[model samples]
Structure formats: C-alpha cells, structure tokens
Target chain A: MTRRRRRLYFIVSSLTMLGVATALALNAFRENLVFFHSPSEIAEKGIPAERRFRLGGIVEENSVAQGNDGVTISFRVTDTAASVPVRHRGLLPDLFREGQGVVADGSLDKDGTFIATEILAKHDETYMPPEVAAALKKAGRWQGE
Target chain B: MANWHRLANPTLFLEWSRRVRPWTGVATAALLATGVYLSLFVAPRDYQQGDAVRIMFVHVPSAWMALFAYAVMAVASAAGLIWKSPLAHLTAKAAAPIGASFTLLALATGALWGQPMWGTWWVWDARLTSVLILFFLYLGYIALWQAIDDHARAAKSAAILALVGVVNIPIIKFSVDWWNTLHQPASVLRMDGPSIHSSLLTPLLVMGAAFAGYFVVVLSIRLEREVLARQVRTLRRVQSRG
Candidate 1:
C-alpha cells in the first residue's frame, strides 16, 4: 500500500476498534451497574428477593444476635426510617458493630432475609461510612453533623 | 493541522519547557511542602481510624496522579500518531516511568492502609487487580519503546498500543462499584458530592494539586532531556554517514 493508503488504514482500523470497545464497555456497564439500595428503597420497589444487590444502613441497636452454632450471625440494618434483617456466615470486619453503618453485598431470600456473602462495616465517628454517607446524601437522607 | 507540527518542533518545545521549568519546579516544591505539613500535622485525627487516615493524603493523590499521567501519555501518543510529530512520541515516552512510579506509590500506600484497617495485606479484588494491570501497562509501554531501534516505527506501534490500552482507565475507575471488592468504594469522586468531611477534604485536594504540579515539572524535565539526547543522536548519525 502507498503511504496515504497505510495512513488511512491505520486511522480506519483504530477508530473501528475503539468504537467497538466503547460499545462493549457501555453495554457491560449498563448491565453490571449494581445500584446500592436502602431499606426504604426495598420497601418501595419490592425488589425481588432473588436479585443480588448492595444493602447499606446503620446496624440497629440491640438487634444483633449470635447463632446457636456460634459462627453465624444476624442483625437488623436500619436507615433511620426502615430496616432489613441481614444474616451472614463469616467473620465480620474489625469495625463491625451495632449503631455503626454497614454495607452488605448479598441477595434476599424468599423469607425476606438478606443473606450477605460479604459484609463491610462502617468506620469513623460519623454514623455512616464515606460511601454510605455519599449515597445517603444523594438520597437526601444525610443530616449534616 | 500544520499548526500541530509547528508546535511540536523539538527546539521550540525544549525552549518552552525550559522557560517554564523553574516556575513549575518551585511551585511544585512549595505545594508539596505545604501539602505534607497540612496532611501530616494540621489535619485532625480521624475519630475512629485516628492517624491512619493521614495516609489518605498520599494514597489518594498518588492514585489520581497515576491515572492522570496515563491519560497524558495516551494523549501524547495519539497526537504523535495522528499528526506525525516526533516530539509527541518523546513526550509519551517521557511520561511512562513517571506514571509507573505513581502507580507503584499508590499500590504500596494502599497496602499499608489495608494491613491496619482491613486486617490483610493484599487481596485479588477487582479494584486491586485493575490497578495492577494499569501498572503493567505502563511498564509494557516503556519496554516496547526501548525494545525497538527504529524510532519512527516504535512510535507508531506504541501509539497504537497506548490507544488500545486506554479501555483499562474506565475499568480501573469503576471497579469498586461494579464488583464487591475488599477495596472501599469512592468517597471523594461520587455523584452525590464528596462524602469526606471538610477536614480531610482540605488536605486531600491540596495534595492532589501538589501531585499534578509535580507531574508537570517532572514531565517537562524529562521531555527537555529527551530533546537534547535526540540532538546528540542526530550529530552522531551525520558523522557516521559522512
């Protein structure tokens, strides 16, 4: 090919490749954008119990319970307006505790329990983790301290 | 455009970068000193994490600079390829090691933060994995240029590679939100506004500014050195041919 022809080929091929990659990225992004939901959102949407999602809120006071087997644990996660019961079968983060914020990644069972595969406990003096705080602010739930 | 070619003349770039070099260097030094002081001494201890949050001032800025440098390198590569400008390739080449250094800094600092808070030194989480890939991309880019003896061909191939690799940028950015990684989701770069309190925000932004200034200063130094080296190479080539 001539020099101009080669230059044209390079431009054409690179742009096409970039275009295809971008399309794929956007499609995957749309499908995979996991939106975090609060208890109040759960109440409103009635999101199917089978759908996986992130559930974030403050762990309600006096709602934590140790399982009889001694490894499993359960608690009620609250967003000041509503609460969802969550259960997990693993060691929680060092910062996990009642009255602190938490984000549990899991799917809900038919019985309305959030079966968390992973639990991230909130840290900091504020009631919310930074991500939770941002999400809360977006949802208009943040009461600035 | 022809204007792009004129702007990329090596002598012109060298002179321009040299003229601004001292200003950028002094500004970067001043900002870095102020940032370190504010971050290390002025910022209040986290109510919970205490002194550990100070790592944010370094970790966050390094990550941002890593991303920014990669972006600069990629843009330079594109400009060089599209405009047939040799100086643009040199700019991209100069940027690679700087980006790689920043990526390494971010990773090491992240590990330090993790060991104390998360109780583990490392995990093969998505966010971590993507950053690791970005670091490798920088290394590969630098290595590709070095491995090729023909500078023009090297620029062409490496520029194409850089363009192809840019897909990784968005992946690195959204990894936390897309996956349930051990890495925490973004607090500062969020749609709902930064969740960090003002006390932490102040130092973080200042450090970010310092890092950007440092990149400009360092990049100009590298670019000017490359231009000088090219002159030496050209003189040798003419002598050998004669």
Candidate 2:
C-alpha cells in the first residue's frame, strides 16, 4: 500500500474507535450519575420518588428507634438545618451512632422518609471523610465547630 | 510552524520538550505544594468528619490523573497510528506507565480511606471493580508494548490495544451509577456543577491542577528521553552501516 493510503486507513480506523469509546463513556455516565445530596437539599428540593440517590448527614441524637419487628431500625439523619428519617432493616455499622456523619443510598418514601437500602457510617471526628464533608458543606449546613 | 511535518521529526520534538520541561516541573511542584497545604491544614474540618477528609487531597487528584493519563495515551496512540509520527509513539509510550502509576495511587489511597470508613479493605462494588479493570488495562497496555520485539510493530500493536481499552475508562467512571456499588458517583465533574462547597472545592481544584501539571511535566521529560533514545539507536545503525 502507498504511504498516503496507509495514513488514510490509520486515521479512519482511529477516529472510528475514538468516536465509539467517547459515546460509550458519555452514555454510561449519563445513566449512572448518582448525586450525593445533603439532608438540607433533600428538604428544600424534596426527594424525587423515582431516582435512586445518596443522602448524607449526621444521625440525630436520641432519634434512633427500633421497631416491634426488632430487625427494623429507624433513625433521623440531620445536617442541623434539616433532618430526614431513615429506616434500615439490616445490621448497622460498628461506628453507627448519634451525631455521626452517615450516608444512606436509597429513595425517599412518599411521605418523605428516606428508606435506605444501604447505610455507611462516616468515620471519625478529627479526620473528615471527603464525600460526606463536601455534601454537607455544599448545603451550607456544615458545622465546623 | 503550522505544518504537521515539522513535528514529525523526533529530534525537533526533543528540543521543544527540553525548553518546556523546566517550566512544567516548576509549575507542578508549586501547585502541589499549594494544594497540599490547603487541603491538609487550611481547609476546615467537617462539623462531623474531622481529619480523614484530608485523604481526598491525594485520592481525588490521583483518580483524576488516572483518567487524564489514559486520555492522553489514547490521543497519542491515535496520532501515532495516523501520522506514523515517532514522537507520537514516544508520547503514548511515556504516558502509559505514568497513567498506570496514578491509577495505582488512586486505588491504594481509596482502599486506605475505605477501610477506616467502610470497614473493608476491598469490595467487589461496581466502582472499585471498574477501577480495578482500568488498572489491568494499563498493565496490559504497558505489557503489550514491552512484549513486542520491534519498536515500530510494538507501537502499532500498543496503539491498537489502547484504542480497544478505551472502552473501560467510561465503564470505570459510570460503574457506581450503573451498578449498586459501595463507591460514590462523581461530585466534582458533574453536569449541574460541583456538589462540593467552595471551601472544599478550592482545595480539590488546586490539587487537580497540581496533578495535571505533574502529568505534563513527567510526560514531557519521558517523551524527551524516548526521543533521544531513538536518535541514539538510529545513529548507531547508520555508523554500523558505514
């Protein structure tokens, strides 16, 4: 093959590959972009019934309650400005407690309570975890004190 | 200056990179220093989380670089295949290991952070799994380049591999959203703008810039080294012929 023809072949092939890869990336990110929202944002915007997303805040003190079923644990997650009730049916994290940062991934129930499919305890006081801190601070509910 | 042919010469590219390396290195160091200071000490601790948030300083940048490095490699690979430019091949070759290193750093730091917070060293969650795949892709690309005996053939094969592996980059990114995984989705580079507060964002952006600068500095230096190595080999061949 001539040099020109080879060069043309390379260009056409590479461009095709590039186009396909980029398209795949954009498509995936679009469908799966789960935004982490603070309790305050969830309060203000109101949780979308259909979209699955992450809600982050501190578990409010004395708000945790165990239902008659014994397996269902209900608690309130708050950023001080707003609070959302969270109900979980599984074992809680070792560090799970009141006044601790928690991120719950699930959707809000029709009555506005957050039904968490999975719960993660945001660890430690002196060392803030990135995602929780960023979400809280973004909502202007971050208490640095 | 406008002609693509001018950049086709490895010797010319070497000289150009040599002039740029010093500035790139300086900028990288300066940005890193500023980013570290801001992220570690200056940034306020969360009302809830105290100090562990500092890990983001390292984690976020490394993740960004991992993706950025692969993008750079893919672009260079495309250029090398299209123009058959020796400089482009070197550029792609130099970027692969560096991108891999960044991916490694991101994974390691993520594991460290995850352990303390998530109570696990590793999970087969979608995000983590996708990143693992990216790391493997980098390893495969680098290994493919090294496995081949001939330089031209190696470049061609590696370029093809890179183009193929480009599929994984998006998969790594969207895995969190697509699959029910432990890893969280992107907050910084989202369509609705960064979900992070300015106090936190300032440091994240600074660190990101530092990581980008570091990649450029290292890439240019490596590219220059590869160009010189190629020139030396060509010269040795000509002398052997004489």
Candidate 3:
C-alpha cells in the first residue's frame, strides 16, 4: 500500500478502536449511572417503582426519627418546593443532619417513601457537591447554601 | 513504503503539520462552543437526575479522552519501536503529558462529582481504583520519558513500558462489570439501548464530540511544536559540525 493509504488506514483503525472502547465503557457502566432528582420532580412525575435512583436535597429540620430497631433511621428530605420521606438502615455519615444538603440512593416503595440503600451527607456547610449544586441552581432554588 | 521514511525528516513533518493545524483548531473551538451550550442550557435536566447531571458533560468526556490519549501514545510507541521512526517517537513523547493531564482532570472531576453524589470524596471501588491506576500509568510514562538523558534511549525504553501498560486499559474498563463496586455501570455506549433519556444523551454526545475535537487540535499543535524543536536541534548539530 502507498504511504498515504497506510496513514489513512492507521487513522481509521485507531478511531474505530476508540469508538469501540467508548461503547464498551459506557455499556459496562450503565447501571451505575444514577440520576439525581430533586424532591419536587420526584413528587410531580412520580418515581418509577423498581428503578434504583438518587434523591438530593436538605434534610428537613426536626424530621429525623430513629426507629425502634435503633439501626434504622427515617427522615424527610426536601428541596424547599417539596419533601420526600426517607428510611435508611445504617450509620449516617457525620455530615448528615436536618437542614443539611444530602443525597440518598435507593428505590421508592409502593407507598411512595424512599427506602435508601445508601445515604450521603451533603458536604460541609460552604460546600455543595457540584452535581447537587448544579441541580439546585437549574431548579432555581440554589441559594449557595 | 519507501516514502514513509520521508516523514522522519523533521522539516517535512513540520510542513505537513502547518497545513493541518489551523483547521483542527477551528473545528475544536466550534465543537466546544456548541457542546457547552447544549450541555449547560439546551439539554433538559434529567427527569430523574435534575441539573447535577450536568457534571457528566465534563466528567465523562475527560474520562474518554484520558483513555483515548493513552491508546494513542501506546500505538505511537509501538510504531516507533518497529520502524525506528523519530517522528513517531516525538509524537508519542508529545502525547504523554497531554494524556496525563486529561487523566488528572478526569480523576479530579470524578471526585468532585462523587463527593456530593456518593457521599464520599474517594472510594476503593473497582472502577475508581482502576482509573486511579491509569492516572499513575500516565505519570509513570511521562516520568520515564523525562528521566533518561539520551532522547533515543528514553524513547525506546518508554515505548516498551507503554506497550506493556496497555494491558491495564482493558482491566480498568472491565473492573466495574466484573466486580461489585460503588461506581455505576455503563449507560450510553451499551450493548442495549442507553438507559439515559434522549434529552440528556444529546448533550452528553455533543460534549463528547467536543472533547474529541479538542484532543485533535491540541495533538496537532503539540506535534507541530515538537517538529520545530526537532528542526532546531538538527540545525544546531549542523552548525556544530561546520
């Protein structure tokens, strides 16, 4: 083959391999790609029954309740416009608290309560996780808290 | 086949790069402009994810580029080794730092996005760990290139290291799938349909294209710079001989 043809072949094959690698990476990570939804959106559209997802907002003040089992804790998460009840059975992160930004991952129960498999305490007071901050900003409720 | 060696001449490579660099730069800028707009404003907030999903716009593309750049470096290294092509050596050398930068960006953005979403700044999860290793590999490749004093010897040694390290790329990619980890599995480029909504997919795609364009633009520019430096070195050698 001519030098130009060989170069063309090299470029084409390299790009093709890149395309394949991307496809593979995306496919492999599909399930882990969780979307973070605000409470209002979840309430308005109604969360799917079986799909695992995430909810992020402030933990509502005075809404945290420890269950009789001691290990189980329940709380309400809100984004100011709406609130969703969350039930988590684990050690809450140190940063978790009422009026603090938080994200919970799990599925919605039949009764519409969020049964969290994981609960992430929103970072420090000044800190907003980029995703949570962006989501809030887009929703027009971001007050930089 | 004979003409392939002609490109080894630094002057010829410089001339070719001059012809290609402008178009790549323009294309990169245009793609990035469209991508940022689409990602930040046009794409609908994910029905499930809200606006925070926007992080994917920057995070995923950088990750893709990190992997892509490493592959480019590995291939260039292989070419240099087999053909003793000085231009290939320079191309691989030029690409290493850029690849390392992208890997760093990917890791940092992923951490920033993860802290709020995952509730932690770092995780030992399979996917995250592998990416961390990939970053280290990039660092090692760059260091290997810099540590050796003889340019040709350094190139040859680094080429071997890069080719060997290529094995880690597949391992990194498959780690999430093969092992249970906190990191999410794939979404857009899947065997099945993308799990994400088209609204989000559109922006993600635009951003990914923009990243690819950016890589080409930067690679071309850096390649041109390397060619010029090579020309200067040759001139210095000739003058010393005279």
Candidate 4:
C-alpha cells in the first residue's frame, strides 16, 4: 500500500476509537447520577409519596430508641439545620448508631416519618462519603469533624 | 517537536534512557522514601477512618497508575501497529506486566481497606468489577504475547486486544457514580474543590508523583532489556547465516 493509503487507515481507526471513548464517557455521566437528597432538602422540597430515594445525614443525638421488641428502632436524621424522624425495622447495619453519618433508601409518610426500607451506615468515625459531606454542608450542618 | 515519534526508535531509546537511567533510579528511590514517610507518619490521621485512611495514599495512586499504565501500553501498541515499529511493540510488551502488577496492588489494597470500611472483603459493585476486568485484560494481553511465537503476529494480535480493552478505562472511572455501591465517591478530583482535608491530600498527591516516577524508571529498565534481547536474536541469525 502507498504511504498515503496507510496514513488514511491510521487516521480512520484512531477516529473510531476516539468516537467509542466519547460515547462511553457520555453514557456513564448520564446513567450514574443518582441524586442523593439530604434531610434539609427533603424538608424544604418534599419527596413524592412512595418515591424511593436516598436520604442521608447525621443520626440526631438522643434520638435513637429501641422498641420493646428490640428489632424495631427509631431515630431522627439531621442535616444540622433540620431533622427528619426515621423509623427503620429489621437489623441495623453494624456501623449504624447515634451521631454518625448514614444514608437510607426509603420513602416518606404523609405524617413526615422516614420509613427506611434499607439503611446504610458510614464506616469510619467522623467520616461520611463525599456525597454525605456535600449534603450536610448544603444544609448548613457540616461539622467537618 | 512533531518528530517526537522518532523517540520510539530502539537505538534512540537505548542511548537516551542509558544517560537518564541513573537519575530516574535515584529520583524514584528518594521520592518513594519521602512519600512513604509522609504517608505513614507525617500525614495527620483522618478524623474518621484514622490509620485506615493511610491506605488511601497507596490505593488511590496505584489505582491511578494502573489506568495510566494501560493507556501508555495501548498507545505504544497503536504506534507499533500503525507504523510497524518493533521498538514500539517491545515497549508495549515490556509495560504489560508492570501494569498488571499495579492493578493487582490496587485490588489487594482496596480489599484490605474495604474490609474495615465496607465490612466486606469483596463486592460485585461496578467499580470493583470493572477493575477486576482490567486486571484480567492485562493478564490476557501478556498471555497473548507468549501464546504466539512469531514476533510480528504476536504483536499484531496483542495490539488489537489492548485497543479493544481501552473501553473499560472510563467504566472503571465512572463506576462509583454510575451505580449505588459500597465504594466512596472521589475526593481529590471533582468539579468542586477537593472536599478532602489538606492533611490527607498532601501525602496522597506526593505518593501519586512517586508512583508515576517509579513507573518511568522501571519501564526504561524493561525496555532496555527487551532491546538487548532483540540484538542477541539478530546476532544469532547472522551467525547462522554465516
């Protein structure tokens, strides 16, 4: 093949690869955005009934209580400025406790109780995920501790 | 300046890398020593994770390097296939194991860190799964090189696989954001300024620099060895002809 023909082939293949990469990047950006709303945001603009969404915040101090059955638990989640009461049944995550970072997925009742179907507790002390940190900051509750 | 591709020529690489080799080695040693000290001792404990956060200095850099090394290898393979350059193929071949080792380091460290934080040793999360695939792709690339005895054929086939595998790079990067998983979102790189405290960012960045520097030094050594092997093969062919 002539040098010109070989150059054309190289150009075409490189462009194809570039095109594929761009497509994947855009798809990833669009699909991966799961909006995690903090308790303050939910308080300001309410979540639709039965809308499954992620709610995260610090577990409010002195709000954690074990029911008579022991498996049922109740606590208030706070973004610092506002707190939402949450009632979760079943086993709590190993890291779940009062005054720690947490993210729960469930829906709100008309009475404004967060009935968490699934609860996720942060692993480290004073450490919440970056998303949790952002929500907390936005709610004016960030301790940065 | 556009003649930068000429650097891929084996003789040119040999001459240049020889002169710079000792400096790269010294720099790699010093930077790594300092990085280790800073990451382990000098960096303040994270308010939350405490000592476990030190793993970030090692894990994040290795994870970054694993992606970086594959990109380098893929580009080198492209050069080899496009220009029919043996030197480019050898460079790409030399880089495969290094990339694989970095991927392994990232995975192993990630598992150890995850155990305490996530309360699990492994998860089929998107980020973790994509990285596991990357590690496999590295192994496959290396295996392809050995499976084919003909140098030209082996390089041609292996280059195609490397090019195909480039799709996974973005997936690995975006996996945490794309799906709900146990892994935390990025701290250092974001549209907003890094939310991580400076105490953590300092050692992490320094370790990242040290890892990149070490890759260059090791790649140069591997490429030098590959070039020498080629010379030996050529000399034997001449002797047999004589």
Candidate 5:
C-alpha cells in the first residue's frame, strides 16, 4: 500500500512539473507559434516592408480585381477592422473567392501593397446543406461570408 | 480490495473480456455499415464544400479515435505503474498499434481533403504539428517495448513514456483555438454545442462510434494474446525449476 502511494505521488508530481515547464515554454514562444498574422495584427504591429511574413484575413467583398494583363490579381484582405491590398501573379486556389478566408505569403511593397508569392484558402467549421444556407441568408442569420 | 485483486488476475480478465469481445466485433461491423451508407447516401452535401464534405465521415472519426486510443493507453499505463497490474500494461500495449493506425489514417485523409480545399498538402501549423507528435509518441512507445528484453523493465519504461506523452493530448485538441492554424476550430465538440448541421453530424457520430467499437474488439484480441504469452512464459519457468 505504501509503495503504491509513493508511485502515485511520484507520477502526479512529475506530471505537474512537466506541465508547468511546458506552459512556460509555450508562453515564451507564443508569438512564434501563430501560423499567420491577421490584417488587424499587422496593422497594429506595422511589419517592416523588407520582412517577409504570412498575412491572413477574409477577402473583402467586391475587392477582387484582375490586372490588365489578366495574369495578375488584386484583392483586399480584411478583418472587419482593417484591410490590406494584396497583389498576386499566379494561379489561385479553387476555393479562393470574395468573402472567404485567405492566407498569403510575401512581403510588403514600397507602396504598402502586399506582394503575395503564394496563397492558401482557409475553411470555417460550419457545414450545412445549400438549402439551409440559402434560408439562413434569407433570414439574415448567415455569418459566413 | 479483494474484488479488485481478483479483477486484476489475468485469467479472470480474459474470461470476462471474452464474453464482450464478440459483441464488440459485431457492433463494429453493423455500425460501420450503417455509418458508411448514411455518410455516402443520406448526408447532405455542404453548401460551400459540396460532395467533398463526405471526407469528414472518415477523417473526423479517425482523428477522434486517434486521440481516444491515446487517452486509454495513458490511463492504463498510469494504472499499471501505480498498482502493479500486468493486465493494465498489456492493455496499454495492445492499444498502441491501433492508435498509431488511426493517427496515420487521419493524417492521410486530412492531406487529401486539404489539397483541394486549403490548396496545400501539409503545413507545420500548431494543430497539425501536435497530431504528428502524437503519431511519433505512439511509435516511440511501441519501440521502447521491443527494445527491452525483460518484460517488467520494458513495461515500466513504456509506461513512463506513455504518461509523459499524455500532455500532447490537450495540446492537439486546443491547438487551433490557441494558435492561428489553417485547420478549422472544433465544430462537433464545443461549449456551445456542435456547429455542424444535424444531417452531417449524425453520420459523423455514427462513424465515430463504429471506430470506437472496432478499437474495443481489437484491444480484446491483442490483450488475450499477451496474457497467453505471459502464462506460457511462467509455465516454462515453473517446469525448468521442477
């Protein structure tokens, strides 16, 4: 009985210690752990023009435009509070559309336009049938853009 | 205390487990058949994703089982280490490979779904990275068992590893919420209830239950083999002594 008790205490204490150490480490590296920075975060932090970083947000409605050459695309990514104009010269993902979440990798241009080297679509957790979605839209209950 | 000790006996454990093993096997087959039918034929297509949403029936269930199996292994390891229960160690050992398979399935299915939906095959986001670590932990636990010749020493070492790796479970679960991952947040499991519509949610849940039933069936079979092997080893030792 005493041995079992000792084992229990040891395991519990060690797990606690490990948990605390992990918490500390994660806290220290919190900034580095984020997969991408939102437009709002970038707007507040003001990333340097030369520093390459991923910019993520929803593609603002009616902001997508094609360049005269038809090879380049321009869109404004928005987080409701802030928006960033991004220019890309490549194929976009099939899911890329107006009012959809997107993450772009590149650096800011001299004119503050984001030059995207690559782009990825972001999916939301919501899943429903087209009819239900249409009904939600009609009812003004659809949050998904 | 007496009943607890009796329950710990490998022979008794096997006898009781045998009664339930066949039932679990049947349940797994039945549930999986119905789940597959519902997922493929009955579940409504997503408004945004269309028919591509069908992947969730398999991917979500495999991902769920991956985490569930690890939890079982961790708890059993802790019990074995604390109470000196050989059956607990065997249970943990039996679960490792099954859990690893589920983890692999989840990763593969996620990649398949991500390619067209997210436009990437893989990323080092927090949620994805943590699940990959879980797969490695399962591998490490299984390798530790094979590396040691002595059964007791092997069980002890693997138990420690299993317990230490338990920390990854919560991290994998909440990584999307805690970090800016491309992976979507929880839809089925949340404080506000499932965000997914019932048409899709029903099939996903049925598949999840089927996977759980499959785990129970496989665990029982592997555990029976482990117990028999131990008994044979002990019998040989006794004969040599005589």
Candidate 6:
C-alpha cells in the first residue's frame, strides 16, 4: 500500500475512535452535562427537597406576586406539563417577566416551593422588530413572550 | 496531484495569495462598513431586549468566525500531516492567533451581552463552557508551536493537537441541544429557517461575510510572512555552513 493510503487510514480510524469515545463519555455523564432540570423532570423523578439543584422553565403568566417587603417575589415556573413555585429575594434580572424563560438555583422547601438564591433569565432563539412583534401579537400569531 | 503540488510550491502560493489579498482586504472593509451601518442604524429594536439585542450582530458573527477559523486550521493541519505540504503547515500556523483572537472576541462580547440579558456575565453551562474549551485549545495549539525548537516536530505535534481539538467544534455546536444551556440554542442555523426576522438576519449575514473576508485577508498576509520567514531561515543556515 502507498504511504499516502496508509496515512489516510490512520487518520480516518483515529478520528472515528475519538468521536465514538466522546459520544460515549458524553452519554455516560449526561446528567452532569445538563445545566438545569425542568419542573416535569424534577417532579417525575421526585427530587429530594434537600438536594440543591437548578429548576428551569418559563415564568408562568399571572403567577407572579410581590412579597410584603417588595424585596422578595414569588412566581411559578412551568413547562406546561408541570409547574414549580419559586420564591426569590432581592431584584430580578432586567429581562425577567411573565411568559419568559428562567432558571432558578436552590433547594425546594417542605411545601415544594423552590427557594432561589439566584435567578437567571434565558433568552429564546426568536428575534424581530418590536413593530413586527406587535403585529404578530395583534394577529394572534405570536408564539413567544 | 500535479495541480496540488504546483499550488503547494511556496513561490506560486505567494504569487496567487498576493494577487488575492488586496481584493479580500477591500471586501472586508466594504462588507464590515455596510454591516455595521445596517446593524446599528437600520435594524429595529427587539420587542423584549430593545437596544441590547444589537449586541448579537457583533457577538454572533465573532462566535461564528471563531468556529469557522478553527475548522480552517484543522483542515490545514490535516493536509500538512498527510501530504507534508509546507504551505499547509504555515497556513495552520498563520490561523492560530487569528482564531484565538476571534474566540476571545466572542467570549468578551458574549459576556457583555449576557450580563444584562442572562443576569450573569458567565456560566459553566454546556454551550458556554465548550466555547471556552475551544479558546483554551487554541491557546494550547499556539503554545505548542512556540515551545518546540524543531520546526518539523512542532508542526507535527500541532497538527495532531488540531485534529484532536476538532472534536470540540461539534460539541460546541450541539451543546445547547444535548443539554440545557442559558446561552440559547441555534438561531440562524436551524432546520426551520432562521428564527430572526429578515431585517435582523440580513445585517447578521453581512457581518458574518465581513468577518470571513477579514479572516481570509489576515490569513493570507500571515501565510505569506511564514513562507518568507522559512526561506530566510534556510538561507541563514546555508550561509552559516558555508
């Protein structure tokens, strides 16, 4: 066989092995790789109240309310299939709003309310002019917050 | 193979690249000018993000270029290793700093965009972390090239590193899908057409093209320098022996 052909074979086989190895490794550590768990996942899996974890989902519409001090807020995070109530102190991010994606970190209380030490807003993939967005809303074509 | 050999010749490669450099430079300037204008003045504010959304115009393109340049470097590294092409090794060498700069730019701009939007300047989420790994890989590749005294050995080691690091590219691209990430999933490169409206998408595409043109221009200039530097090294060695 030619030297070129031999080099080609070596490269191809090594690359394949590397890819398979990565795939297997990623698959094995899938839970650790996940940044956050949805309400449904947490609920279905019966996450212990003591385990510190991140709960992520959309901030359900009309589910937000202010605590007596105004420094604390309570809201429900939902994946439509399930919703987890979350209580957060201090200020929310600028982008935080109803019908917006959020990821909150902390453990659940005995009542199952997530006590968040940190709140992070998650942006969706959609982008458009405000005017276009308004028109979509007016036409009932808007699919996002 | 003959045609490949002809192009591989340093003198011929220099001649062709020299002819192409000015055109690429001009293209870079023109496209960047137009893209910036469109992004800043023409594109409307986002419904949610308002003015902050404009950051994506710069952030997305730099991130795209970061990945694109690495892909170029890895391919060149492969060619260098497989074919023993002098031009290919130099091409990979030329691309390292440029790709690293883009990766850094992407990370910086991402931080700028993330602070207000995501409520954090950084995260160890899959998408963000993988891109950070890519930046480190670029740094490691550049360090390998500099640390080795023997040019041939340096090139071979760097090529192997580049090939291994190519695995991160797909990981970065798919990280958003494979795991939950705060950085958001693919927008423009989705199966369903781009989620961005045309007004926003046009400027983004223009900026992407501009970044590509800039990469080409810089890569050619650096490649040309690498060729000349190799010639000078060879001449110095011969003169010392004489």
Worst window of 10 by summed lDDT in candidate 3 chain B: B44-53
Can you rank all candidates by TM-score, best first?
A: 6, 5, 1, 4, 2, 3
Task: After superposing candidate 1 on the true structure, give the runs of residues whose Cα lies further than 4 Å from its correct spot.
Answer: A1-60, A65-92, A99-145, B1-6
Candidate 3: Cα lDDT at A121:
61
Task: Encode model 4's per-residue lDDT on B1-242: one tens digit a residue.
Answer: 23546676678889999999899888888889988999888887664565778888899999999999999999999988888888888889999999999999999999888776545566545577677778877877776676565678989988998999998898788766776555666777776777676666777888899999989989999999999999998999899999
For A5-94, candidate 5 gives per-residue lDDT tens digits of: 655555555445445545544653565368899889998998989689889999999999999999999999999999999999997877
Over A59-141, each residue of candidate 4 has an lDDT whose tens digit, in order, gives 88899998788788889999898998988897565556677777777899888889888776654323333555667789999
CAPRI quality band, candidate 4 = incorrect
- Which candidate would rank higher by TM-score, 2 or 3? 2
Which scores greater on DockQ, model 3 or model 5? Answer: 5
Off by over 4 Å in 5: A1-32, B1-4
Candidate 5 has an interface RMSD (Å) of 7.9
Between candidates 1 and 3, the DockQ winner: 1
Candidate 6, residue A104: the lDDT equals 91
What TM-score does prediction 4 earn?
Answer: 0.71
Comparison by lDDT, 1 against 5, better one = 5
- Give per-residue CA lDDT, model 1, range A46-134, as digits (tens): 98978988787788999999999998999999999999999999877766788776778899999999999878764432322355566
Tell me the TM-score of model 1. Answer: 0.72
TM-score, model 6 to reference: 0.91
Scored against the native two-chain complex, candidate 5 gets a DockQ of: 0.32
Chain B TM-score, one value per candidate, order as shown: 0.96, 0.95, 0.93, 0.95, 0.97, 0.98
Judge candidate 3 at residue A17 and give its lDDT: 43
Preferred candidate (DockQ higher): 4 or 6: 6
